[model samples]
Each structure stands twice: as structure tokens, then as C-alpha cells.
Target: MADLKLKDLRYLVALADTRHFGRAAERSFVSQPTLSAQLKKLEDYLGVQLIERAPKRVALTAAGEEIVERARRILEASEEIVELAKGHRDPLAGQLKLALLPTIGPYLLPNVAARLRKQLPRLELMLYEYQTDPMLEKLHSGEIDVGILALPVQMDGLDSYELYKEPFTVAVPTSHKLASRQSIKVDDLAHETLLLLEDGHCLRDQALDICSGADVNEKQNFRGSSLETLRQMVAAGVGITLLPELAGRGAYGAARGVTIRPFVKPVPTRTIGAVWRKSSARREAILALAKLIEAHAL
Candidate 1:
């Protein structure tokens, strides 16, 4: 058998994750044929059949599964070694991949991205927007260095720092009865139908939790895919929805037809935080970013 290559191992791991040649190729940033050929070459070198080919689907052989498991550990360790060296040199000097919840990214990032750029000019910030669960998946898989999301999430093998407690506000159409109010109580939402993001959004769940004491009904016929969509729906006189304080700030939506009002005393809020893998070597970078976010409180 010949010596193993790390890139080939990466290709193999990508295949294992996607279970499709075309998708694996895309994940590996290679052409389908190239990835397939290298995978075949790897199998030949190892003297075993790793992948079972089929017209409709791809399946990994038992040997492929075993090797894929090992490959993942090796890849993680390899990345750790690189991260360790970079941390030693300058923890925040390299590319920092971050994923944020869609509900927060649009509203929050605009407020802090410029600051991050000015403070860590040497660090290249790569940002992505994903809903809560998928973002956590990327963080755990090491595809992203850190994640910004709602706090109290069920995180295993991850460390988190609370950045801010952002209060939730009510967004109602200007013509609605409640629109004239300066502030409303949770009971005001009783028996009201709310436009909300589709499932898989942590915001949706958080909204429901806030109204748990009240009898708030989620609109069944429609679910907004994003906060902007929900805001538009509310503006169209569809129904009221909750918006994080940042989303209601002047820069984000500030919709013409939508009236945003705060809650009365004991305001409902969500704790936003930065999360990273516990084993991550970029502690200094993560902490620095967290500090910046914490400083720019909502």
C-alpha cells in the first residue's frame, strides 16, 4: 500500500457526509470525475472496495464506513494542529469562519461587522446565515469556527458566552387596534394569531415560549421564511409577530406600515451568545470577538 494523502482523506469524509458523488465533489471543491477518480485511486492503494456504485444512489461499504470514521478524526486532529500553530502566531490573524442565525445576522451583524473589521484587520471574517440547528451542525463538524445564536441551547461539547440580552418587541400593522399603544403586556397577545418563521428557526420557538402563558396561535396557512418576510406579512395586515429589538431598530426594517412597540415591565428577552467547540484552539480569537459583541450592547 502507498502512503495516504490528507486531501484524499478529506474527499472521502466529504463523500461519507453527503453520500452522493456530485454533492461530495461540491463539498470537496472538485469536479465529480476528479473526486470519483481520486476515491477510486485511494481504494486501489488500500486494496479494497470502499464505495458501492449505483445509478440512483451511493452507498459506502463496511470498509468505507470504518475508514471514514478514522478519516474524520484524522482530519479534525489535522485542523487542530493548524489552528494551534496559528493561535501561537496570532490567534485572530487568519480566516475566521462564523455562522449566525438568520434572524439575528441581518440585524446584528450590520451593527458590529465594521467594528470587527477595524479591530481585527488581519483576520478575514467569513460569515454564513443558517437556522439554529444547522448552524450547530456546522460548528460541531468544524465547518465553521464559531456560531452566534440564542442562548440556553442544548449544546454538547461546546462552550458559550452570553453577549447580550435583547428584548423582544411586538410588530403590528399600523391599522391594528394595538398599534396605538406605547407598550403592551403579554396578556395583550392572548388569542392573537402571530406570523412567524417556519419551523427549524430558534426565533419561532422563542416567540412561542414568550407567549406560552398566553393563548397565542401561530398562523397555520403561512409561515415566513425570515424575519423580513414576517415583518412584511405583519405590515400587510396579516397578523402580529415578535421581533428582536435589533430587528426593529431603525436600520433593519423600520417598516412604514408596521408599528413596533416594546413590552411593559418585565420585558421578554432572548439572550444572544457566541458559541464554539470546547476543543477549539482559537480561544483568544473567539474571546476577542465575544468581547466586541458584548461591548456593543443592544
Candidate 2:
């Protein structure tokens, strides 16, 4: 450890993450030869051949792979140490990279983006929109600072705060007889054709659970890729579907021939939350974004 250099470990981590010398060099902001030479120095010092190199690609040796894993942990801890020191100075007014599940991104971002810019003038915000799995992956790898996702991510090494629960409302064609109902219940949709989003959407799963609990079958004749598509399908009398509160508002505003109804019993709802790696360095900033969203959402 007497001769260990932070630059050497950083090079190892970049190589491990990118799996290509040139790309790793790019990430580390060093020339390819400089990165390669430093890695060679590191290997020589450790008395181990860390990587098998060829003109085409690079592969890690057994010890190299093991070292890479350790390198990742070391680099993460080092970065966290720096971040923690910075956090001690100021919890806000730093770079914040955030990701959100697709279902919530479009519906929620517009409402709060301007306010965030105004409130935290010195805070730089970077946002990404992704589905559940990829969003969680980015969170784990420290590729992003925080994520807004549906509840029950249930992943290890992450802390989650439940922001709010939004109920599911039924979407029906305005001309359909059931659209006139004072309130639609799951049982009421038993005989109705139900449209749904394609698989992988958490909203679709929540909708299915609500329908199943009431002994209603979701008709799969038509599936939409997005809430807007589902609204179009409902207006076309393709089938009925359930939408979250934000989506319901859009249908009410722009979409024609679609009526939203609250269910009488067994109302469907999903909890939205802010998720960050348990080891994250910006707890205060993450919570700040969560509070902002909660305030605007309500």
C-alpha cells in the first residue's frame, strides 16, 4: 500500500467497466498509451499479469478479474470519501444526476422541472428516463445519483422513500354506456373488454392485480405501448383500461371520447418512491428532489 497510486486504481476501474483499453482511456481522460503503460506498471508492481491483450480486444486474467472487482469497491469507496467530504460543506448546489421510470417521467417532470431550476439555482440537474430494470441497474452502478420508481424495487444496497400513492382510474369510451356510471367497480368491468399496456410496465401489473382481485378478466385483444396509446385505444372502443392519476388528467384535457371513473371498491394504487444506492453520498439532495415532487404532485 506504500506505493499504491490513486491513478493506478482508477485506471483499473475504468478498464474493468469499459472492457476496452481505448474506451477506458477515454473515460479516464488519459491518452490510450498513458493508460496502457500505467496499467502495465501496476501489473508489474503486483507481480501479476492482469490482462491478456490482443490487437482485437482485451480480456482479464483470473487475478485480473479478481483485482477488477476489488478495484471497483476501492474506487467507489474513494469517490464516496470525496463526496462525503463535499457533502459536509454543502448538501445542495452540486451536480445531481437522476433517473425515472418511463411511466412517471412525462407526466411528472414538466410540473416540477421549472420550479427546481428556480429554487436550486446552483444545482445542476441531469435526468434520465428508463423502465424499471435498467433504472435500477444505473442506480446500483452509480451511473446516476437517484431514481424515481414504483415502489417495491426490493433491491439490496438501496434506500427507498415512499413519496405518494396514486389510485388507478378506469378509462372508457365516452360513448360507451358504462362511461355514464356514477362509479365503476372492478366487478362492473367483468363483462367489459379490457385493454392493457404490453408487459414490463408496472402500471400494467397493478392494473391486472386490481382486475384479478375483482374476478375481472383483462382482454388482451389490444395492447398499447404508452398511456397515450391506451387513451387512443379506449377512444377507438378497442377496450377499457385503467390509468394512473396523471395520465387520467391528459385524457380529460386533450383526448376525446374517453371518460375516467373512480372504482367503488378495491381501488388500485401504486406507491411512487425515490430510490438511491444505500451508499449514496447525497442523501440530502435526493430527499430534496423527493420533497419537491411530493409538494407539486399533491
Candidate 3:
């Protein structure tokens, strides 16, 4: 039997991940026919049917599932080897893929990116925005190098460095009764209609936790997909929503008809942090980035 190539293994993993020929081909950066032919060659070389292919679906055989698990480790190790070689050259001069949650990215990344560019002039930063779950999945799978998200994620196999804590503020229409308050407590929001981001966003869960003991009820009929949308809803007098400190200072807060007010003492806050795999080879760079983020978080 011929020695299997790393590219073939990558293709197999991509197929397993996407479960669609065209999608896998796109991810592997190859044409559909080419991916199909290579997969066929791989199957013939191994003398086993790895996938059950139908017109609309793809399923991996039991052996294929096991092979994919091993393949992922091999791919991760290969990346570590490349990163190790690069690490010896420069600490922060190569491509760094950073994942950020939508809740934090728009409010924080501009300043952080500017600082990183000035400090590490040769660093090429690639930013990808995803919610917490998918971002962590990508980090563990070696698809992304680092992730910026709320801390206390409760995930294993990852190490996080605390950057800063951001407090949440209440956003309401200027005409709303609470908008005139100097500062309100969590209990003040008990009877208010709270607008929240959709389920996938960590901000939603954080907001819910803040209002846990209160009598606040989420507006079940509608959910904002992003912070801007939530701000718009507040401006339009739909319902009040919680905004992170940085977000409240952004354009949304500056928008007319929307007033942002802080919570009284012991405010609800989320700790922002940088996270990466514990065994990653780019630890030094990630830590450096984290320091820069911490400095600029204010």
C-alpha cells in the first residue's frame, strides 16, 4: 500500500466536519471533482469504504470516524511543529488567527488591533467573529489560534488570561422612567421588560444571570441578533436591554433617544479574557497579545 499523504488526511477531516462534498471541497481549497477523486484514491489505498455518500448527505463509517479522530491529532501536531519553527524565529511576527465573540469584537477589537499593530508591526492578524461555543470549538480544533470571550467558561483543555472586567449598563429610551435615575439597582429592573440577544450569544446568558433573582421578564416575542439591533430596539421604545460598558460608550450609546445608565454598587460585570489550548505552541505570542488587550481594555 502507498503511504497516505497529509493532504488526503486533511481532506478526510474536512469531509467529516462539513459532511458535504462541495462544502468540504471549498474548505480544502480544491475543486469538487478533485476532492472526490482524491477521496476515492484514499479509499482504494486503504481498501475500505470510509464514507457512505448519497445525493444529499454524507455519513462516515465506524472506521472512518476513528480515523478522523486520529487525523485531527496528526493535523494538530503538524500545526504545532510549524508553529514551533516559527516561534524560534520571532515571538510576534507571523500570522495570528484570533477569534472574538460578537459582543466583544466591535466594542474592543479596534483599539486592541491598533495597539497590536503599533507594538508588533510585522504581525499579521486575522480576525474571525463567532459566538463563544463555536469559537472555543475552533480553538480546540486548531482552526483558530486564540479566542477573546467572557471568562469562567467552564471548558477543559484551555487556559485563559484575564484581560479586564466590563460592567453591564441598562439601555432605555430617554422617555422611559428609569432613564432619569442617577443609578439603578438590579431590583429596579424587576418589573421592566428586558430585551436580550438570541440564545447563541453568551451575553444573553450573562444578562439572564444578572436578572436571575429579580422579577425581570425577557421579551419572548423578539430577540436582537446584535448589540446595535438591541440599541435600536431601545431607541424605538421596544424594551430595555443591558449593554456592556464598552458598548454603551460606542455609537449605540451615542445614538439619539437611547440613554445608558449604570447599575448601582456591585454592578453586573463580565470578565473578558484571552483563551487558547493549554498545549499550544504559540503561548508566548498569545500571552503577549493578552497583555496588549489588557492594557487597551480600558
Candidate 4:
């Protein structure tokens, strides 16, 4: 069998990751027919089928799964070599792929990204927005160099540095009784219909944890897909919801008919942090970015 090229392995990995021909081709930056033909050649060269093809679905064969895992390791090692070389040049130079959660990105990034550009002019910053689980998955797979997310994340083989502790605030419609309060306590939430983000968001779980001390119940029939949606719901008097401090200062909390109140002493908060693979060669760059974010995140 002929030796496989790095690009071939990359295509296989993309296909394995996405499980769709069109998406894999787009990820690999190749045409669909080109990716298909190259994959066919790879299969012929290896004398085994990599994927089970159907009209509407793509499934990796057992062999494909094993090969894809090996391909990931090889690609990661190759990237590490490149990063090691770049590390000696300048700590903040070159491309850095960073993943951030949707909850934090809008409120925090706008303030920090400009500072980053001015401080590290040579740095090429690439950003991806995702939820905590997918962000961690990308970090572990070496698809992203770092992740900025809310902490207390329990994942092995990664290191994180706390940037800031962001407190949660109660958002209520102007007509709501809680809106008249100067401050709120966990007990105040009891028996209130709390609007929350849908599943897969860390903020939703964090809010639930804060409410655990009280008898707070969720708006079972309604789950906002984003914080903006929840803010809208609150402003419309649908239900009250929790907002991160930064978010409270943003446009969402400033919407008409909405009132924002801070929690009393021992306020519920989530620690935001920057996390990277423990073995990453871009540690200095990631740390540098973290420092910049920490300075402006508040």
C-alpha cells in the first residue's frame, strides 16, 4: 500500500467528524467530487472501505473509526511541531484559534477583542462560538488552541486559568413585584416562573444550581434559545430570568419594561476562564490572550 498524505488523512478526519459529504468537503476546502474521488483512491490504496455510504446519511466503518483516531493524533502532532517553531519567534505572533461560549462572547469579546488587536498586532485571531461541551471537545481534539468559558468544568487533560467571577442578576418585567426590590435573594425566586435557556447551555445549569436553594420552577413550556430571547421574554412579562452581570449592562437588559436587580451578599456567580490542552505548545500565546481578556472582561 502507498503511504497516505497528511491532506488525505485530514479529509478522512473531516468526514469522520462531520459525517456528511458536503460538510466534510467544505471543511477540507475541496470540492465534493474532489473529496469523493480522493477518498475512493484512499480506499483503493488501503484495500478497505472507510465509510458506509447511503443516499441521505454517512456512517464510518469500524476501520474508518480506527483510522480517524490515528489521523487525529497525527494531525495534532504535526500542528504541535508547527506551533513549537512559531513559539520561538514571538509569543503573540501567528494564528491562534480560540473558542468561546455564546453566553460570554457577545458581552465580553467586543470589549476585549479590540484591546487584543492593539496589544498583539501581529497575532491572527480566529474565533468560534459554541457551547461548553463542544468547545471543550474542540480543545481536546486540537481543533482550537484555547477556550474561554464558565468554569467548574470537569474534564481531564486540560488546564484553565480563572479570568473573572461574573455575578448573576435577576431580570424582571417592570410590572412584576420583584422589580420593585432594590436587591434579590435566592429565596425571592421561590415559586416564581423562571425563564431559562434551552439544554446544552452551561448558563441554564448554572441558573438551576442558583435556584436549587429555593423552590424555583422553570417555565416548562418555554425555553429561550438564547439570552436575548430570555431577555425579551422577561420584558414582555412572560417570566423572570437570570442574567449575567455583563449581560445586564448590555442591550438585552436595557430593553424597555425590563428591570435588573443584583443579588445580595454571597451573590451567585460563575467564574469565567481560559482553558487549553495541557500539552499545547501555544501556552504562552494562550496565556497572553487570557491576560488581555482578564484585564477587560469586567
Candidate 5:
């Protein structure tokens, strides 16, 4: 560790992440030979082999894995320090990564992103459309700086701030008997086939939990890989489905024969929130994104 420079640590960490010397070098903006040489020096200083090099790929040794884990935190901290210093001059002038849940991303990101780019001109925003599990993983791993997801996640080691609560609505075919009803109860669809997104979607789970007796995989009629697909299926009279309030607006406009009606008494709702690792160093950036989302959602 005595002779190990910050640059050398960085090269090793990059190699660990990319698992390719050439690509790591490209990411570090250094020549392959230079990065390889530094890595060799670091290994020599440690008196152990850190990487197993082959013609086309590289694998980390046990020691390399441990060191790389620590190196990632060091690099994160170093980057945070730089950002903090820069923010002293301008509060928002660095890269920010925000993860959005699949259900919400398509419906909300476009309108929000346009306003964000205009307001924070220097902020380089990276958007990731992800599901609940992967979104939380990225947040904890520092791969993503913020996440927009439903509340009641009850995840440890992260903080969530509720942006708003959106109600669930019933999606039915325009010609269906229940289409003209101002609001439909869960029991209204109890006898009808219920279309839902696949298992991975949180909304699917929400729908099932809300309607205890409703059949989710009524193979004869239930299916959709996305909200749009569900809307289309509902329009085709395949089955009725539940949709979030945010998605109801204009969701049926493009589809041929569908209508969105609110729920009757005891409606189900989901709380959407901004989530970040409690230990994150990018507090300001995370808060800024949360504020942006809240403003745009309004």
C-alpha cells in the first residue's frame, strides 16, 4: 500500500468492474499498456497476484476482490469530495443517476425530463428504468443515485420521501356494461376475468392483494407484459384491469375501445416516493431530483 497511488487504485477498481483490461483502460481514459503496468506495480507492491490475465479477459483474485471492494468506496468518497468542492461554486453541476420504476417511467419521465434539463443546464442526468428490486440494488451499490418507486417497500438502509399517493382505477372496454359507471368496486369485476401485468410488476401484486378473490392468471383471459399491453387487451375485451391514476390520463385515448373509471368506496392507492441510500454522499443531488419530481408530478 505504501507505493500504491490513487491512480493505480483506480485502474485496479476499473478492471475489477469491467473485467477487461482494454475496456477498463478506456473507462479510465488511459492506454491499456499504462493501466496494465500500473496494475502490475500495485500487485508487486502487495506481493500477490491481483488479477488472472488471459488473452481476451481478466479475472480478479480473492485479494483483488477484497481490495476492489474497498477501492470502490474510496473512489466514491473521492468523487463526492470533488463534487462537494464544485458545489461550493455551483450547487448543481455534476452527473446524477436516477432510477424510475417501469410502470411510472414511460408515463412520467418525458414531461419531467424536459423541465429538468432546462432548469439545471449543467446537470448531466442519467435515467434508468428499473423494477423495485434492481432499483434498490443500484441505489445501495451507488450505481444509481436516486430511485422513484412505490412506498411501503420497508427496505432497511435507505430513506424514502413520499411524493404523492395515486389511486387505482378500473380499466374496461368502452362497450362493456360497467364502462359507463362513475366508479367500479372490486366486487364489480369479481365474476369477470382480470387482466394483469406479469409477476415482476409491483402493480400486479397490488391488484391481486386488493382483490383477494380475483383470479390473476385466469389463463383464458389474463395477460400483459406492460401497462400499454393491458390497455390494449382491455380494449379488445380480453379482460378488465386496474390502472394507477397517473396512467389513466390519456391512456385509453390511443387505444381503440377502452375507458378508465375510478374505484368505488375503499379504493386502493400506491404512494410513490424518491429513495436513496441513507449513507449516500450525494444528498444534495438526490434532494434536487426529488424536488424536481414533486414539482413535475404536480
Candidate 6:
């Protein structure tokens, strides 16, 4: 299989990720026709039908899925080799790919990124935003160097270090009765319909977990895709939702038409941390990033 090319494998992986030819091509920084022609050659060389092409979508065949998995390992190994060869150099000297969950990215990235520029001027940081599921999958596959997200994640081959604990606050429309309260308790949410992030966000799961056994029912048939959207809804007096402490009281705080209140003693909080594959060669850099976040995260 000397005819096999890593470039072609990357095209296939990109196709698998996006499930559309044009999107995959754009992601790979190539034209759609170039990507299509390369994959066709790859399939011919391997004697396997790797993709099932549809009019508007594409999916991997069973063999394609298996090969893509092995291809990811190969790609990650290639990266590790490059990183290892540079071991004598500064660990954070090269381009570092980092991902953050959507909920955390918007609130924390501004400050963190500004500082990363000043602190590691020689390092080029590539940032990406993803939901928890894809973020974890990329971390496991080494598609990203590290991920900053809510902790207590079930990552089998990964380790994480806590950066900070950000408490949850109740956010309601200015006219809501609870808006008059200076503080709230987890139990006080009982009988109130809570607005939460749509499914698949770790923040949503955390809210559900915190509300478990407290008899607080999530609003039926209504789910917000983001904290900002939820805040806008709250401003319009749709319903109430919980927000991270930073979103409530940090420099970016003060969304008009919403009131924020904290939980009393034993405040409900979520641990924020950086996660990376245990085998990552950039452990030192990742830990260094974690330290910076520990200092700046609220």
C-alpha cells in the first residue's frame, strides 16, 4: 500500500466529520472537486467503497468507519513523532489546537485568549468551539491538543485538572416573583419551571443533575440552545434558567431585563477544567494552560 497517502486519509476523515462534500472540502482547505477526486483515487487504490455518496449528504460504509478509526491513530502517531522530535525545544513553541465547549467558550475565551497571547507570544493558539460530545471525541482521537470544559466527564483514556469552580445562579425575567429574592436555594427552585440548554450540552446535564430530587421540572417542550439565547428569552419574560457565575457577575455581566441571584450556603457549582489524552506529549503545555486558567477563571 505504498500508493496510500496521508493526504487522502485526511480527506476521508474530513468527509466523515462533515458528512457533506463541500463542507469537508472547505474544512480541508481544498475545492470540492479536488477532495472528491482524491477520495475516488483513494477508494480505487484500496479496492474498497469507503463512502456512500448521496445527492446532498455522504456517510462512511462499515469498512470506511473502521479504516477511519485506524487512520486517526496513524495521524495522531505522526503528530506525536513531530512533537517528540522537538522535545528539546519549548513545549509550547508550536501551533497548539485547543477546543472549548460552547457554553464555556463564549464566557471565558475573551480573557483567556487575550492573556494567552501575552503569556505565550511564541505559541500560535488555534481555537475551536464544539459541544461536549464532539469535543471529547476529538480529544480522544487527538484531533485537538487539549479541551477546556466542565469536569466530571467520562473520558476513559484522558486526565483533567481543575481550573476553577463556577457557581450557578438563577436568572429570571425582571418581572418574575423570584427576581425580588436576593438569594435562592436549590430547593427553592421547586415548583418553578426551569429553562435549560438543549440536550447534549454538558451544562444542561449539570443543571438536570443539580435539580435531581429537588422536584424542579424543566420547562416542557422548550429548550434553549445557548446561554445567550436563554438570557434573551428570560429578558422577554419567557421563563427562568440557571447561568454560570461568570455569566452572571463577571465583567460581561448585566443583560438588560434579567435579574441574577445566587444560591445561599452550599452553593451549586460546576468544576471547570482542562482535559487531555493521558498519552499527549504536550502535557507540560496543557498543564501550563490549566495554571493560567486557574489564575484568571472566576
What TM-score, to 2 decimals, does candidate 1 have? Answer: 0.70
Over 4 Å off, model 2: 1-89, 250-253
**Candidate 5 C-alpha error for residue 114, in Å:** 3.1
lDDT of 4 by residue, 173-289 (tens): 999999999999999999999999999999999999999999988998887999999988898898999999999885555789999999999999999999999999889998998
Best of the two (2, 6) by lDDT: 6
Q: Candidate 5 lDDT, tens digit per residue, 194-262? A: 888887788888888887865344545455888998888888888888888778774333567888889
**TM-scores for all candidates?**
0.70, 0.68, 0.70, 0.70, 0.67, 0.69
Report the number of clashing residue pairs per model. 0, 1, 0, 0, 0, 0
Model 2 agreement with the true structure over 1-298: per-residue lDDT tens digits: 3476889989987898788999999999999999999999999899999998978878889999999888878888999999888865777878899888777888877778798888766778898988888888888889998998899987799998888888788888999888899888777887778888888787888888777756565665666788888888889888888988776774243688898888776666888999998888888888988898888874
Pairs in clash, predicted candidate 2: 174-257
**Model 5: residues with Cα > 4 Å off, grouped in runs:** 1-89, 213-222, 251-253
Q: Write down the worst ten-residue block by lDDT for model 6.
A: 246-255
Residue 105, model 3: lDDT of 88
Model 6 RMSD in Å is: 18.2
| lDDT of each candidate versus the true structure | 0.91, 0.84, 0.91, 0.91, 0.83, 0.87
Clashes by residue pair, model 6: none
Clash-forming residue pairs, model 3:
none
Q: How close is candidate 3 to the true structure, as a TM-score?
A: 0.70
lDDT of 1 by residue, 52-128 (tens): 99998889999999999999999999999998977769877888898888988888877888898899878878999
lDDT of 3 by residue, 74-105 (tens): 99999999989876688777888999999988
Residue pairs clashing, model 1: none
Candidate 2, run of 10 with poorest lDDT:
245-254
Candidate 1 wrong stretches, greater than 4 Å: 1-88
